[model samples]
Target: MGRNTRKRSTLANRAIVASAALILGGGGLVAVNFYASAGEGWSSGPRTQRAENAGQQVSTIDCPEVANELPREMPRQARGEVDRELAAIDSQITDAYKKFADQKEQIQRDPQLAENAILNPLKDKRQASIDRITNAIGRGGNKPQGMNNLAPCSLRDDGNDQGDGQNQGDNQDGNQDQGQDGGQDQGGNDQGQDNGGQDQGQDNGGQDGGQDNGGQAGNGPQDDDFVDIQSIEPNVDEPQEGNDASTGSFATDCGVNENGKFNPDNVIVAPGVANGAHHMHDYVGNQANDAFASDDDLANGDTTCQNQGDKSTYYWPVLRLQNGQNENDANADGGGNDQNVGEIQQPSEVTLNFVGNPVSKVTAMPRFLRIITGDAKAFTNGDANANASWSCTGFEDRQLKDKYPICPEGSQVVRSFKFQSCWDGQNIDSANHRTHVAFANEDGECGDGFQAIPQLVQRIVYDVPPGPGFAVDSFPEQLHKPITDHGDFINVFDDNVMDELVDCINNGQKCQ
Candidate 1:
């Protein structure tokens, strides 16, 4: 009732009001923060998780189990699609070749500025074509229907019915073992689950004008779809003999090893069933995971889509195409390590060998060796002797001290490269995990086909020449027979190899 009493009461009431306002604002902020965090997690569940894992220094995901069996042939429709795509690709490539030939002819006639300039333009076009085709095929192409966008399967369907309705007889033993233990708790309809409900199983026929037409998704590569073989004129007459024999068909040439092994495990090649590299794409496939309304939908027919994840699975490492012309044994000079060899080349190699009793014609001989690496500098480097950061940030084994993750510091990961079209157990088997080879290139973009390549379906990893623990004599003899003595295969990791690879870059070389 007094002036003092009224003033004190007014002040106290204002303080209380301010306190309540503060609490409400604070609560609102907290609520919004919580919602934002949850929304982000939900929106980027697979992608963010992959990126985080990428930066992580440790690898918790178990190495993929190798599938010993060859992939069944592509379904007729899929094969047909590939055929069409490849045909178009071939047309483009052929045009490029024609242009290249014309340029070469011009060079033969003029032997001057025209040769230098004209060859470069054609070469760029060729390299672009090669890159486009290689990426398209290797990444399963961009055709909407036939193309699987590297998605994983939904509910981890155990039905081994690849796109075809028929069962492919329960995939691999490893997969079967996993299925038995619920390792792949593919929560969905079990085989022979009660089908008493609704007498009519719905038939959602194929979409009008679907690419499959009426073809069933068969088990493997189509009979008619031929993989392209691009290389110099291969010498069939001079067959590789003994362990020293090399078919000269390496898909990816990382480097040569001075003291490499013949074992397939030590060597790197294409995918095989046993070592788990074969089915890596199953999880990373365009059809990794997908949702279906009913079991009938799956039975009706649908290409499997891999589940959401880093879909960059099948991208062959960045390959550095080797120029067959330059063969300088970096180990030839004074028995010291030849730092000049393959220094500018990029992408470290992973091993995949498919040697099945009845190997897939697709696996006949590796046509394309996908070299993948994380070297940021491989493409940028000008010198051949400088160190190439052939380290994929996420994949490299960084625990080692020398920084080079694939091979040890002093010793290099030299793969004793060889190719055997023969179905011999002595060579790489799509079944045995041993046949896949792994090597390191100095650069990141090897698959472009613009660089100088060393050999064929085989890639040879090497140490700087004068390999690891070599005596003096090891250098010269190893130089003469790099592929034989398991010594560094002679190819300039120096200016010469780079110069040749650069020529490839500037002048697109067609597959012979």
Candidate 2:
């Protein structure tokens, strides 16, 4: 999908039309209301009925994305204030999500409680934050209009959408092939069948405390969330190349956070704000990454990258096992405090490769350029920005966007991202932090004003037990759903190193 299209205005219509609500932003995972999973809408009874009867459980709070509604350009001075206000809205949502989850049963019995207790209070808080945002923008830029529509949020109900838990909102058709076919004739590669007596049944009464507790670690990664990789058909089709394609790749070895650099802050999205992410992140490369690290601090900071010239920062939400256990941050912000409880799993392999665009010569990425791939709020936000790819080591060709991969025994689970490669040739960042860069079209060509750059492809593999027991850390409201997985990167390469990288790609030579 192209940029600047937010699925906000029609919330009321979508809610009424489809029995289930349509959550927008990030990797979109749409819960259903027993509607036609990908097509027909669910019909509902009176709003006063029990939630289960009216629809189903409340999936999440659906607030319009205030950031999406802001003016594209704003005064640099007020940017910080607006960013803080945006972060405040996130905190408010996190707090309200906690309250909603705490009183789910009460809300279910008396549906109005969700409106009175959760949505109403959340709307008030968001309204105040949006007011501050408009004021900040008015100081320099055209104050954004339509912000009033962003404050009022509604509840998205849940069901086994598709009866198999597939999100219907990512693509326009609502009918996604999904690559989930239960056909396997991999000969010796049929490891999923070769495994011993590990039941692959959808419902085996997960660990001691599972969905009964309500999520991966008490908030999600439900039984429907995991799909065996072997059942999926091959769907990865590399884009075609032009005759003069810069068909080369460059690799960077930044050991997967071997030193355990962890935090719950998003320096690019929520700078100077503590716990802005409300979820833990495992970082590699730049060690100076935090909520308050400035450009100067990052430039002078030590890096984990073996190549000292590459001081770039790369981080993403941590993956965790849902088995009853707690990490050190179990009681800390972005951790247990935010309902992200689990044993964090360390990646067994992390590969950072920068590949060239297939249709043109690659250019250097500007210093301090930040790139975020995938959407962290995918569960609540639609898949407009979701770029997550999940699969197993042997079955990389078949990647899943909505369901978690249940890797076969002896095979490792893989989470990968191929970041945006087209740059606008002007700003290193955008107000939305995304419009500055765009992904190449299916033809491998950049959009009109964008230029080709070395595309960063990250692949992180984990040797967790082959089952649905593991899930990634996510914001509490995100329900620890796989669709919410995301990755972040900040380019801090020196000019010399940057030039070499561009040359390597343009000359069709693989370099390290």
> Model 2, 457-486: lDDT tens per residue?
999998877655677888776777676788
Candidate with the greatest TM-score versus the true structure: 2
lDDT of 1 by residue, 214-239 (tens): 11101101110000111011212221
Best-matching candidate per lDDT: 2
lDDT of each: 0.20, 0.69
Candidate 1, superposed: residue stretches over 4 Å from native: 1-78, 82-316, 319-410, 415-420, 423-457, 462-512
Which run of 10 residues does model 1 get worst, by summed lDDT?
10-19
